[model samples]
Target: MHIMRVIVILFPLLLASSFTDACLAAEVLTLAKDGNAKAVIVLPGGATSAARETGGILADHLKQICGGEFRVIVESDLKDASVKDQRIVTKSTEPVETFILLGEGGLTKLLGATSADLGPGGILIRTFPNAIVLLGPGKTAPSDPYGTRYAVMTFMEDSLGCRFLWPGELGKVVPQRKTIKVAPINFNYTPRIRQRRIRMAMGLGERKSHGVKRLGFTDADYHYFNKAAMVTTSRDGGWANWHRLGGSLRLASGHSFGYMWEKHKDEHPEWFAVQPDGTRDQSRSPDRSRLCVSNLELIEEIARDRIESLNKSDLNSVSIGPNDGGQTSFCRCDECRKLDPPNSRKLAGGGPALTDRYIYFWNEIAKRVTEVHPDAWLTADAYSVYSAPPVLRKLHPNIAIRFVGLTYTNEEKRRQDREDWDAWSKAVKKIYFRPNVLLAGRRQGTPVIYVHKLAEDFRYLASHSLVGTDFDSCCHNWATQGLNYYVCAKLHWNPDLDVDALIDDYCQSGFGSGADAVKSYFLRLEDITNTIAEQQLKITQPFPPAVIDELRGYLDMAAAATADEPDASKRVAFLRSGLEYTDAYVAAFRIFREHEAAGGGRLLKETKQRIREALDNNWLVSRGIFENHHLAVNVATVAWGSWNYFGRYYWSDPSPEIRAKVESR
Candidate 1:
């Protein structure tokens, strides 16, 4: 009676069409009741690859949840279907039969939505009297029409209580039920960030670690997965279901045009930076070869090159920003220096102010490029000495500036970066949060869970014209920092999402009954990450033995509780292996300290043993999106330095055993 009363109140006009039928209106649209199909999944005529794939995803999941073959068909072919039940009910409530529409079609306008209403990456889900309409843009690549796919997923997630915790099939948590029903539903959503990608260098065929030693890697690297598991992890980890996990707009990142030095050095000698000594050579300077942005000829040439590239294929945006370096060089020509402002802010300590010149250069290029491609965007970074806003000029409408930021662990730096982000929002047509702050390369193989700070920062940026985000890198150490990556993605789609609820969902889905133990474990990691008062304190602080033991205790409990659930058990095992690797690194750091103080072969021996254990543990994690070996190969062996525990002895041999083991492959 309450359902009928609410239905009548909500749709007075629809009630007028069928007063008698309204009395017998179906209270719930049943897709599956008592493990039998009641509705058919329908697609519009001439469905694309995206449409078929999305429909299949919906059908597969429904079958998993409620049992019974859910058929997918184009609207035209619906009449020729050979299912058990083909009785189509238009307005009657008795002997119920319904169709689930998946995308824009002829009846979509009447159902109250169209492509125009839901723009790029927008979604609409509505339950009509006879059908449920899932509407979104028809995009085929990089998660377009993903809006439609997301609509189906959203309905299942929000209404039916499902959770996609991590990558691969093991990561899915589907609740089983014999009877699944839906009440009147109307929902709409669009991602806050245009692109929500967390790029992992180790996955997606970046390296090869076939069972034994392979080209450029040891068997320990685990960078490339085994062929059998690779299909699942790579497809999931490498952008196969990127949209379902909230990844959208894939755009190019900025970089300094450093190659111009080699390409134009002999032919166009004047295009390179001029040193203070009036030499235009890159050979002698520490910050070799910054571009001479003031040169009209150079601007014309760069514009011409970009235009030619655009002519070859389609590009959403073009990136031409400065190269990354601690003390990068810039053009010191008279024309360039004249454009520098008096109160130029320094990104590092008392750095050069190249903001005005670079801004002028970007605007000029934008003007020339847009003459032919008006919608094309020019991307650059608000970084280094030129990080401050331009005082001399305004940016063109086609320019998008990605702020180099998010050092939330450093209070002062975080404040400054946030202020600059806000300031740049006013100056540029678009702004994105592109931070190398994950520091995966620098802090290699440690749990750096800045998730709460990330949520806070992302929420702030989403409201301030922040259009997209691309973290510099991910090591795929999912067991330790999985929450950071997962939460970052969830917020990318829904800027105002509840972080606590998201964490609960993840723990519940991945850990099952052991969720409490797993939740305690990750929360402890988050606490440890946020409490580090100084990010740059170079103090060789011991990675507290007590804390390690405490976390291990939680994992042990999780392992016990999840023993019955095979899927949860696997995830717990993955996390435990990661912790072992972290503990090994910690033990090695302590032993190295003792060796430095007392100078003994025994301490060095202990350090090598710990490192060996680290490698052993790394292999287990590598099987599930962990890039521990890739990090060791990149940061530890060749780039070892006194600053890090792993790279303590590079000049001669820090740890003869570890270095030898790492380099031998």
Candidate 2:
């Protein structure tokens, strides 16, 4: 088994190295001085969405390089003729300069490459002087033909120095070269991890703060997600809308306890959770509300409602959960208690661990639904009190356990996570990790460079039976969080890629003349967080006055470096937006400190105004109302926002209470 594992790992490396050597040693293809080549992008017939999208991307990039002209030939077009003969002959009877083989199927069959041998998301790019063959695992894999698209993307990145940093047109960085050059190239790659999902914050009237544009995320973003199960308009349009571009419409929780109780409490009191007094209570708190899962009738009703709800849309996967809060909200009914054993060993949350009962309930629903819709996948958040793996019974293969991450480096927390993940990996077929990097309220200032820590965590995850990762990377504050966001996106595709070198590429490519200044700015801020700050505190917490001043100086240097170049100047402006937010935050704290020290002074008016302005600015930025694209929800107010930035900043109508008191005096 160990020998087989080594062979599997070394084969791709050997193939890639051989290709690279061959390409480097010989230069057979040449771009005519006239800037045109007899080249065509040949793709699979009756291609899937991934094939069509990738075919278009190859055609577009080829056209750009070939002075706005390139042909795309589908395999169906060459049905009667030999593909080899067609490539060697053209309508003009002149020798065809290049034949760019794309996708799998008839086109790849001409090259004798099969889907199974290529494996899932595996890609092979072999560039001859005259012909370039690109192959991706074909249509058999529905979730991601990640190979073809990632091949095209990596080709552009390696040869053309192009990058899709985040999403949308604005996030893409295309080089300003005028002509095409031909070089021998051979590359074969397969993603180390299977699933890479980024679950951003989304809802009605909410503007996406980071990554893609407002109301739309293009196919470009999907290229970064190979095994992402989240539905999108580009593919799964029935349950999803193009408004937010992409997100899920599946059931999040089995029962909305508040809504259920309001309707059924009086008529069917037995359906409600029985309190310690043996009678049912109808009250609901933010976190403490749950239904009696062990009620046989209740479980039956849930299964019926779930199937009905899922049938409304064609989405294949559903993420079901218990209530909002942690473990304590679980029903303590006699039957419910019979399902869960009291585990004093649980560390994160107290009382009985709920893994057994939750798993049992979820498996029941999954089994029933899958019987009807055989491909249906039922996912549950193994979080809060239910974070531990079920010891009583093995999980159904159709059921997926999603373990949430509270802190990345917390030893005890991660140790518990390791145990849970290892156990679940053995019991179930799929396991997903959702770690909080941005939403955890860390303020490492602009360009949050946690490449070291994130890279470390991802490497560890790859060794385990990690099928997918859903990073809760909400609020794309490019100025402060841009580096972190880019790292997160890149690492998802190839976790073993060198992170520091990637960081250097980002700094130099994104900010040309200001690269050195920007690199210094990010590294210095990272130094403070990694060295000075307490691990327990968030990276977003306010630094001391001296640290704030040091940060301001870094931004000042960055601005000066990019003063002459217009493009770099624009990029520097993005870095400055983060500085502006931080400055306002520091000023607000300073004013409050002075007011408190003086015991009521004229400074009260200024302090209130600063905080109010900061709040208002943050709201505008969060909604994409501001001119700057690289803005974040003011970290100062994230605690109050609670993942609802728009609500906290806009509709909540919160006012400075200190102002009211000062005015009253």
Candidate 3:
């Protein structure tokens, strides 16, 4: 895992590279004659070896830069040496005006302390005539481990005069009298591409699965691994068909995709997911089937066969999912009833009951999987009903939990979603649950709007100590989701990332050099989008009409900013595209207000007609094409509240004109 990058410097043999160099050479000659030479070098414990190596490099560079006699010492062995020895060396050392701590450890030791001894009049209290603390090229000085490192760095820099400098800044040697602006290079670059290696067992119905397999995902999609870093894949999966497509696509991609096979529910009536009301899950009926984990035999067979099959495949791990049967009524079956007599109340919801059974079953399965593939990771989707905290299982140390938070609809619901997240976060951290947050959109709907909401969620999560956050675009059809995914992944990898700068970089990388215009346009668009969001929130609050007017004034200003951009095409396109959302919100708000005024469903028919008209408008079609085809489709899929109306009124019994317009599009 070690990578070496070297920079080489060539100095002119004949001295006159620059006037500054000539003057420095003259000063060095005079200084050397005076015999006023001083050098102090310090090295840390863990990086003592590296510090010594770097010190040699620095000494060579320094000799070239200063052209004066200087002694350089590398103290690489004191990291493990006794404190008494360190004290004796410090006390016996000659007083040197110029001191350089080669690494954090060396600097710490020179200050006569360790991190644990940070008190008043401690290390921070110590001062030298001229001191240079060198942080290694890739290493960062330790900050508050319990809080956000950026916050800690900011606090320290503001409260103390301790300047943070990067390795690049150390290339030049500075005189004791000179003042240098220490600009620390922020190490927060988001990689253009990243890969995640997943090892999990997929429970497949009868068709496949000798056991679970290892898999790889990159750029928010499944890919086959040629090496540890490189992955290749074809078409991403579609809605309601992720499992089937994910398996074959994963395998075909030359990556390890795991699975566990079981008989189809139709063939195994006894193993079908059961509901609290005794009815089976019919959501996405016929396409998806559930499994009853309340049956011990079923659980055992899944755990044993799945693990075995996975071990036999190229899969790095095994993943278990959907488990829709768990959402059905809790198994009132004699066997399940007896096992949970004292805890019946705990499994109140059909979802919770099913999740409990699945978790209990998987715990056993995880044990079996570990026996064979000790290094493999297990993934269980804590999605839907199981997304809440109390229902999720306390997984084994070897198992990892992927908390898929997709059920929430809007920002308000997302705020509530955080409560569930808090519960799950506490549980996982308390039990050392290795958790990854999966912010996903519902399969078929306008939930695409949730992407904006997710940006806020990602920011909040990044502020915490979570391992990482993964954005589920579902597939390429919803490619607009890709924009959100890319942004979230970039932020997740490095929380202190400059998102606006990233947008600029993304535009340049994806488009070309002249795309700076587009970058600027989008940045302004983002600003306006945020402004509108704030306005929407303010309007929802119990503000006076005057306050509301003030908020609208702000919105008007935002609108005006984008109204006359240099790129008329981009401006018009963006504004025209946003009009549908704006119009929809206005119409929805009007209808809601009318209903309140009349104390009933006032103008319900008129409101429905306007919404239908908006959907049927060619603008919607044009917007879809401009944004990307999948964007509209994904949004429509998640627009169930509105879709129900469109489906019934527009599709089922449409008028000739409306039908013709829709068909033309």
Candidate 4:
């Protein structure tokens, strides 16, 4: 896997290690030479949208690299092929002398490589004497095939040193060359993880923000998420390339039984949780409610609901939840408690874990659902108190669990989460991660660096039961935590990729002449987080005043190094803005904490106002260089956001008094 992305240039030896002249001699296709088009791109007959889109992207990139007119045409447009023998590509419909054929069809079948030979999400990029085969199984890619699209992106990055780091023009990195070339290549790759989902802020998935504006999030929160929606839906196709690196596997990961509560509260009240005082617990919101997992009738109803949903629609999986509120709020009914282990232990978040009962619940649903539709999948949100591994039994094969909350901040909690994941891996037939690790820096990020930890998890999980991952949100704070998402996308597709090399590529391509300094700045930031991870800190607790100065020095060095380059300089300044926010946050948080102790209303108001101003300034600074809407709602506005008032806040417009108290002074 490490050698899979080998760059076959002179410097290719650095990435691939194994080098021989045999590679050079095997080079069958000469794409361009002396700034002139040497070959035309020919798509296989009856190409799908995947083939056409990838072909167009390849053609566009080749033209940019060599300043040549690389015409893209379908195989049906080719001249009559009585000469299928030696050079079928020699007489393309276009005047080009050679052709770079797309996809695995007549050309590739003649060469002995085809899509039938590969696995799901598998890619085959073979260079023949007259054409290059780029073929893969085009399934579940938001209407595009990630396999073939990934093949094209792989070529652009490894072969041409072009990178799609972030959205917009500034994040794009393409090396200019007078000529473009390819060596003899036979590469076959399928990502280690099956469903590689990296969702950006306000993406199509999980459309709700957990008690945000709909429940009382501020005007800022509303504006931020509403605007963040632009990237995923952008007409310019900026976010499309990033989507190529991800899978569109619809493993449902939300509160699932809200409709059940709404429909059955009056008729089947026993299906719901029972409070300590014996009244059946219920809520208008599914997240605010709890379920009595021991209710056999309730389990049957859910299974029946899933089977009906499956019979009607082609949805990938249906989610089953223990819902939002934690353990103490869980059903204390005798039947449910009977499933608990004799010596139930408390987890870091407080739990005589309900994981066993939830697992029992999903396991029961799996049994019932699979009886009706054998292939129908059930997704269990193994979250909250039930987030840990079940004590009783392994999950049924038809059930896939999505483990949320990889606590990256507190060392103890993170370790427990990983251990729980390891345990859950053994107990479940299928598992994927959905960690909210990015919330470490709180909302207005400190550019928290957890690259190594993320690398470690992905590498380890790929070998385990990891089917895929759903990183909570790709916080569009590119200037701050973009590396997290960048490295995340690369590793999701291929877990064995060199983390250091990916970071080097990111720093060098985006930061230009200041690559080394920029790299150091990020590594240093990572180390800062690492050093303080054991402290069990919250929000600004990890960042120190002295460290901010040290980070500023690294940015200053990068600024000096990239002074002659506008794009690189602006990026450095963009990072500086994040650092300034971090600096301001630390100070503001300290003041708020001090005010908390002294009961100083003046100091608290001053700190909240300061945070609001800093957020506004950060958004202004990101205008030309970055996406402005992703300045988080919860973590960023912690001192004033609706998170603190989760149960009370509503999505309606705030009253003058409520807005002043929570959002303003």
RMSD of 2: 8.3
Candidate 4 structure quality by residue, lDDT tens digits, 173-209: 6566767777666667666676777666553222334
Give all candidates' CA lDDT scores: 0.64, 0.57, 0.37, 0.67
Model 3: how far is 451 from its true place, Å?
8.9
Model 1 Cα lDDT, one tens digit per residue, 1-665: 43344334323334344233432453457888898877788888888887887787777777778886788878776444322222233432324366788998655655555656565577776666667788777653344446787677666666565556544455566678887787766556566566766665543232222322222234444434323223332122233244354454545556847567778888998987776678677754334457778999999998887777667756667776766662335777889988887767654556556788789888888799889778888888888777877877888898888888768456677777788888889998778877876653234456766777788888899888887777766544455676776777667677676677677767876798899999999888767765553554322242568888999999999999988988889778777766766665455455556666786554355566665554433333332233422322222211122223344432222335644665676
**lDDT value for candidate 3?**
0.37
Candidate RMSDs in order: 6.8, 8.3, 16.2, 5.6
Highest lDDT: give the candidate number.
Answer: 4
Regions of model 4 farther than 4 Å from truth: 1-23, 27-29, 81-88, 92-94, 139-145, 203-244, 247-253, 284-288, 315-317, 325-328, 349-351, 596-665
Measured with C-alpha atoms, the lDDT of residue 591 in candidate 1 is: 53
Supply the TM-score for candidate 4. 0.83
Q: Find the candidate with the highest TM-score and give its number.
A: 4
Ranking of predictions according to TM-score: 4, 1, 2, 3
Query: Please, what are the lDDT tens digits per residue for candidate 2 over residues 138-174?
Result: 5555545556665556555665555554433333455
Model 1 stretches astray by more than 4 angstroms: 1-26, 80-96, 106-116, 139-145, 200-227, 230-253, 256-258, 275-289, 307-317, 325-328, 332-335, 367-376, 439-443, 533-542, 594-665
Using Cα atoms with residue i matched to residue i, what is each candidate's TM-score against the true structure? 0.79, 0.74, 0.47, 0.83
List the candidates ranked by lDDT, beginning with the highest.
4, 1, 2, 3
Question: lDDT score, residue 526, model 4?
Answer: 84
Compared with the true structure, model 2 gives a TM-score of: 0.74
Residue 287's lDDT within candidate 3 is 36
